[model samples]
Target: MTTPRKVTSLDVAKRAGVSRSAVSRVFTPGASVSDRTATKVREAANALGYRPNVLARAMLTGKSKIIGLVVAYLDNHFYPTVLELLSEALEREGYHVLVFMAAHTAHDIEDVVGQILDYQVDGLVLASVALSSDLANRCRASGVPVVLFNRKLEAEGELAVVSDNRSGGRMAADHLVSLGRTRIGHIAGWDGASTQRDREAGFVEGLHAAGLGMFAREVGDFRLPRAKAAARRMFDTSDRPDAVFVANDYMAFGVMDVLRAELGLRVPEDVAVVGFDDVPSAAWPAYDLTTIRQDAEAMVTITVSSLLAEIGGSNVTPPDPLPVRLVRRGTA
Candidate 1:
């Protein structure tokens, strides 16, 4: 039986009337190849079905060009928005994203990360995750560049692309104070996560700066029902706050639902409310939530670019605290 001939670089070089060395140099990056010869080699290679093995090329260059994208709690809109930007930005940089969803717990990542590391990813972007400092240290020690997105590392010298959480919290406080609302309370995110902790601290400091005392706060774990429970507690108590700032818009929406449906309270009039993240629903006519807007798209873009740069051998360090802004609406 006659078998089809296996195409090789020599065949391509012969067909293109160029030396095999020229064909090899044309495929290899930073290798000297004339423009006239490169065109001929590409055309010949295309006709001969001689596609280069990307894995082998990457191994030769000591770069995998695969990005590990770790997203915890994608149930929140913020993570999904960040993920969409990350996928697009990474793709544009000739890198593929190996996505992993960490179920809402630091413990869950222990098992999931094994797979991400197995993919031989060039770099990693942790999307609002609360990785333990020890695990993060191990990741760094293993020679993978890790960049945190929308979250900060507790330890020093760790790379991160994080929003100005303290500033965002202060912004929320300033807006509430401007409305002449006192007795401000906070509905915070997960207690262990850096974003939640920093936002809570910033809000507290901001209220202090405005000459107001923080009445009380409850942890929502960045969830709806938990936020509702916290808000319900505030409503049920005899001594309750007049206005509240809930960290993240999803929780804020939950707080609003409780205020309107369960407690029958009017927003801004009865209990002025604010939230963080400023998710798409924040600007909707129904919610119209006055919240701190963390530019999810921009954050994702910068993080992806930084990670790709590191993967491609660029010695780039991401900004310590990424920028966040205020998106004022009607809740407060």
Candidate 2:
């Protein structure tokens, strides 16, 4: 085999008739170099097959240009939308995303955080962090800036961007109530997540606003089989609810399946239903689900942009909660 060709900063500096510092500054992000000097360095680099060493530059500047993204929402289609947007946005900002996935288990979150630390990422975006208070502290101690999106952690002082979950829930409740739905019920997501808690709170608050209370409710845990079980129990009641609001579209699909096939209930007539997250499947010909829509693309864009700002050594300003809306469809 032929020996690998080695290109170094010294070679570029010699060719450009400049110091090594000039070549280094030319490759460094946001570093200042004279236009003539930069042009010479570029020409010399191209001629010599010289490429900047990203790893060495990171060591020198203490910036990896890598942002770690932790997610716990693979089961929902909404998460994939977020991931796709984040990848594109981060790429544009010259920061690479190092994604780590955990499927709703809070138990292993610390370990995953540890893995992120090992990668020496400059910042972190928590898409669906199942973070305990202690785990949050651990991440803070690691000196990596964290920005939470879609899911908020219990620990205060963590930068977060989320939709107006409560408002979205209330809107759903009010819409169903306006349609003359009286016996209303709820399917809550997993108990631990702050997002799920806020949604449930908002739905309950909206019912109170409508001069009513929930006829029944169950914990769906934001999963399919568990949600189906919750739906089954609620529908099997002697006083079955006329309308139900499930926490997410993925779980809602399970609820609808059980209600139609097993319980033999006609949707929007026997029992109206609404859900959240507005996954593409929600508007499909078969489901046509009316649901709360949190703009996944916008959320991802904000998260990635924020992380890149931190990675670029800029002072990142926290953003306010994004708005969510209800997308109407045939199911309700």
Candidate 3:
């Protein structure tokens, strides 16, 4: 038996009694086509069961209409929301998202990014994952535009969109101080992450501005288990913190669980708690966590617009940091 030949646009144009360019315009987004001509093209396409070859179209136009997204981890509640917003925003622009998960090791990141490049994506978005300078240089040399979402790389010529985490940290500190927390401590996230450093710095600045200093500090590494362990050490000490500001809501949940379930400490009574990233779980009755809201929708919108601007041959300046707000709740 012989395989069937694929349907072509020319065949549809002949069947519809229209020019081949009319059929092309009907399938091409943003291309001009009359309503009657589009209707006739669609009917002919449906009757002939014809579909445009996207790969061939991409080869001809030098555009894949695909954006590559690299993410380090999705366990955090924040990133899942970011992914959803990105997908929706890109779809509206007639683009699709291709996700790539980079491992912890540099070698793994290089390898995975190389595979993404193989797909010839029109642009790339890195979410909380930094590419090595060498890999970044390679991407630049290849002429593919990249935008960093919720993180920043130290390399030049890279665009980033992030919340004003420093201000959020200051807000958290001021809120705790207003609550009359004398002995305040903090559970920091990963040491190397830029977000962690900025938040910690702002927290310290806010504390000093209020004539107070951090009582104790622990590294959570943005992991629940590590946060729990850090909470144990802090609470077990004789001078436990009267208030604790966790780096992110995921770690905050672990810290709260350790304080309430494991140590039988009453939240906001024994120790007030605050967190960053007003994740959905933060609003639950059990947690009701006071947190800094990082507007995911705004971040996603800016990121997509910046990326598309670059892809459209426009030089994009780094966007100003998005604002964050403190969402007051029962915890603090």
The regions of model 2 sitting more than 4 angstroms off are 1-27, 31-53, 236-238, 308-318
lDDT of 2 at 181: 97
What overall lDDT, based on C-alpha atoms, would model 3 receive against the true structure?
A: 0.90
How many clashing pairs does model 2 include? 0
Best by TM-score: 3
- Please list the C-alpha lDDT of all candidates, in the order they appear: 0.82, 0.86, 0.90
Model 3 TM-score?
Answer: 0.89
- In candidate 2 the C-alpha lDDT for residue 29 amounts to 88
How do the predictions measure up, each by TM-score?
Answer: 0.82, 0.84, 0.89
Ranking by TM-score: 3, 2, 1
What are the per-model numbers of colliding residue pairs? 1, 0, 0
lDDT of 1 at 256: 94
Model 2 C-alpha lDDT per residue in residues 1-332, reported as the tens digit of each score: 99987999999999999999999999998999999999999999999999998878888998878888888868788888888888888888788888898766678777888888987888888776677767767776777878888887645566688998989889989999999999999999888888888888899899999899998989988889999999889997668999999999999999999999999998989999999989888989889999999888888778777766655567776777789998999889
Of the pair 1 and 3, which is ahead by TM-score? Answer: 3
